[model samples]
Target: MQNMLLFFLFILFMDGVSGADETESVMEGDSVTLHTNLTEIQNDDTILWMFGPEDSVVSQITRKAGLTSFFVTDKERFRGRLRVDQKTGSLTIRNTRFRHSGKYKLTVSREQTTIKIFNVTVFGVVGEMDEVKSVSVMEGDPVTLQTDAEIHSDDLIVWRFGDKGILLAKIDVETKEISLNDDDERFRDRLQLNQTGSLIIKKTKTENAGFYELQIRGRESSQRFLLFVTGE
Candidate 1:
């Protein structure tokens, strides 16, 4: 399916398509929208969103007299997590999971055929598995590293950054309060935490690409996240 899509798109745009929104990286349980870059869809135009490897359909959009209808194709696989923008034909996947990671093809057909491909990566939720999972994010995009475990009432969760293990944020579940350490000023005001013990880095910077550790104080378990930043 992937090969067929690539070959068909290559034939359609032999010269190439400009500025295809090609890559997106997100964490598990997050939402991502792939834009079609169109201000509006004409009545005669039909848009199809396909996911490959198998090249299965994700959703299709068509317009009638004055209204648009969206048909979600792989509903069982996506479990009703797909959405589309009526005007732009952009597709959004809510509460994304690892199985949602793949290449998506957007085909806009009207007077002519235009194709765009997007590569999406969904990082697994950090757990006590103690694995160094690789995460990718675009510069200036916010990325979150979330844990799968529920916050215990008495747990003190600590999030650390970089190889030096700089303190980033500490969360107190008992008090529902957080203490942030930005003495290095690198993260300054771009770091935050959620009640789920997730570390969110906003406006991601290239230097922020490194090992991130999540540990609960007094526990012997820890998990690491290796992040890579692109497009400075």
Candidate 2:
């Protein structure tokens, strides 16, 4: 009985000496990897890994006894995705998503001394733009442009028009780009940023038609436009 008490005391002492150094970064689909040095731990020491801002217990491994245990939180997001490798102090998270981004801490305790702290980063999936079609607009009419979103995020909108590719107008939101070719030469002046990623060409004419394109960047997306000009 006395030996058991002493052993418990020793565990506390060792744990107190070493605190986990954790690093966190957002990852796509709710996944992340935690890495740290465990070389100094004795073959007999039991190491435990955990999750959450409070460092709630998640799993444990005893190398000397060849024993292991996993105790995960009831959170639906975690489910079976949280894992720990008994042979090494490595944690892997699968099926990551935006909501999975958060602070996590790890603590390693040996029978004698505590050694290192690791801070890890998990990357969140950011939306991105991949491709779009080139277009040309006429001198006086309305132009509509369009593109596909590769990822999901708040929409960031920017338009490029005119021969010099001047900045037009933007409505920062998640609306998809449209394919519109302007038809007003006065588009050079009457150009108005519209709700449809559309360009209004007040009065239809010949010179207003030309190449127009869109440049959009969002939390997790990007796009470019190419407007083609022609006589209408």
How does each model score on lDDT? 0.79, 0.51
2: Cα error in model 2, Å: 21
RMSD of 1: 14.0
Model 1: clashing residue pairs? none
* Model 1 misplacement above 4 A: 1-21, 126-232
TM of each candidate vs. truth: 0.48, 0.40
lDDT of 1 at 227: 66
lDDT of 1 by residue, 1-232 (tens): 9999999987876543434447787878899999998999888788989875345788899987877888886566697899899888999999997667656778888667777777786777665224556677888999999886666899999998754688999999999999888776668888999998999999987667666789988766577776666544
In model 1, where is the ten-residue run with the lowest total lDDT? 12-21
